[model samples]
Target: MIPQIRSRVLWIVMSGLVLLLASVHLMIGGLDQHEEKSQRLRFLPDGHFLRTASLGYRELTADVLWLQAIQVMGERKVSPEAGRWIYRLLDVVTTIDPKFTWAYEAGGIALCTLVVLPEESNRLLEKGMLHNPEEWKFPFLLSINYAFELGEDAKAAEAMALAAQLPGAPSNLGRLAANFFVSAKAPQQAIDLLSDLYEKTSDPGTKSLLGERLKRVAVERDLQLIEGSIARYRQSHGGLPSRLEDLTTSGILEKLPIEPYGGRYEYDPHSGTVRSSEISERMTLSMKRRRDSL
Candidate 1:
């Protein structure tokens, strides 16, 4: 009985050892296959010549391929299956090289422009920013979308402020922050910021741009003030004035402020309201597109 038990224990131990060897061999084989595949993909047609020239052709090829994939995704009218495939490819590329700024930028642009998902694009930009906090482009893109695309001026102002604080942000970003503040109905703050920027900038081109932006902010603030006064007058009188001159007679406004954009504020007599006549058509279209996509 003791001999039989010893033989059975030896058989079990040998089986276990064989299984462990098989597992290790399989793992090593899989790793070698992966390495071989990576090597083949890393070599281009002129890889030998490029290597002799000391150029990083393999990395450049990866970047070019990333751009091409993003472009195709942007231009194509993709089905769910195609979208999934494209998204997976992008995820793989970004995961392999998290610091590839162009990959992140292209991915964000494609997702926003083609996928029509602002929140998703924002997530991508946020991830990129995590890897590269010094890059101004991600914050700038986020701010522009918040202000113009999302119509959330407060968030836009926050993003613009961050961008302006970054190392290489263009000087014009300060003006963007001011514009965002004005859009959020904080005219005094906007005026203050713009006034400071205009005073500080000495370059002619930058100064001209800042001047135009400040003038626009001033006009928008005046328009809002005039409109509020008109609203109060209507609350008391039960109606708006028939013309701009009527506002003065009705004691609502001392004088009509000329729009800084060189036109009188447009009045809708029937609604007793006024608005900018030359509203940005691009913003209007963007809003419409957003609604349609939703």
Candidate 2:
């Protein structure tokens, strides 16, 4: 009886140890397989095939694929084929889960920034709009693509109008939309749009881009004001002034506007034009040549 009891206890302990070892092996195998999958994700089956294979876990499978897509896009260097690869990955993720609005937004913005493909970005955002009619972000992004890349302020205004009408949208979007519709040529309107976009976006890349654009527009606006003041100074004084300071000294301007990039304004008597001192000499010469041509 004692021998039988000891044999039973030993059998139970050995079985538990076997089970623990088996579980550890399974976990290590799963990690290995996951790493392999991530490395070879580009060679995976297409969305249609994966969808069919998801076994009723379409959304879950898509979530995983979307994460992989993000990894692929962020890690990949800029190569000729990188854009195409990113588009394919994003397309697959969207195809599997059409209602994933964040995926669409990220993909659209990535296409624009990474690939410089505004048309493709527009198509992706438009598709997101169709899937998420009640969501305002898609149309807002579409407006950005149109205004910045395509230079279609009218279309941008229309899209912004749609965005403003959507639930949860900001009340001030209407004013920005109206500005875009009223004038395609107004730098102020561009500035307003960019400022709004810069504030609304949390993405560092998009915010940086908007900041640069805003600086350019602000510089342009200051240049216009300086030019007008210069004209007024010449009208009163009977010739171009010796320097930009003369405009302020003669009361044409209260004080010269501060340069957007922290450089003093310079006046060229030979060209009868004012330029920002911060502008590179190359850019100054290019602008002078363009004015001469015009």
State every prediction's TM-score relative to the real structure: 0.43, 0.56
* lDDT at position 169, candidate 2: 80
For all candidates, the clash counts are 0, 0
The local distance difference test score of each candidate is 0.58, 0.68
> In candidate 1, which residue pairs clash?
none
Q: Write model 1 residue lDDT over 1-294, tens digit each, in one string.
A: 999999997777656545533443343234334654223222222323322322323354344435435444644364433344344445544554557776656555555444445565577677778888998767866765565446678888888889889996767778768777775545555456557756755644335544655555565577677778778878888887677677788877888787776766877879876776643323213556767889
Q: For residues 74-190, write the lDDT of model 2, one tens digit per residue.
A: 653434355555566667767777898777777777775544566667888888899889988789778766765566789989999999999988777788788778864345655
CA deviation > 4 Å runs, candidate 2: 1-45, 75-80, 185-294
Task: Give the 10-residue window scoring lowest on summed lDDT in candidate 2.
Answer: 279-288
What is the lDDT for 224 in model 1? Answer: 72
Worst 10 residues of 1 by lDDT: 38-47
**Which candidate number maximizes TM-score?**
2
Candidate 2, position 290, lDDT: 43
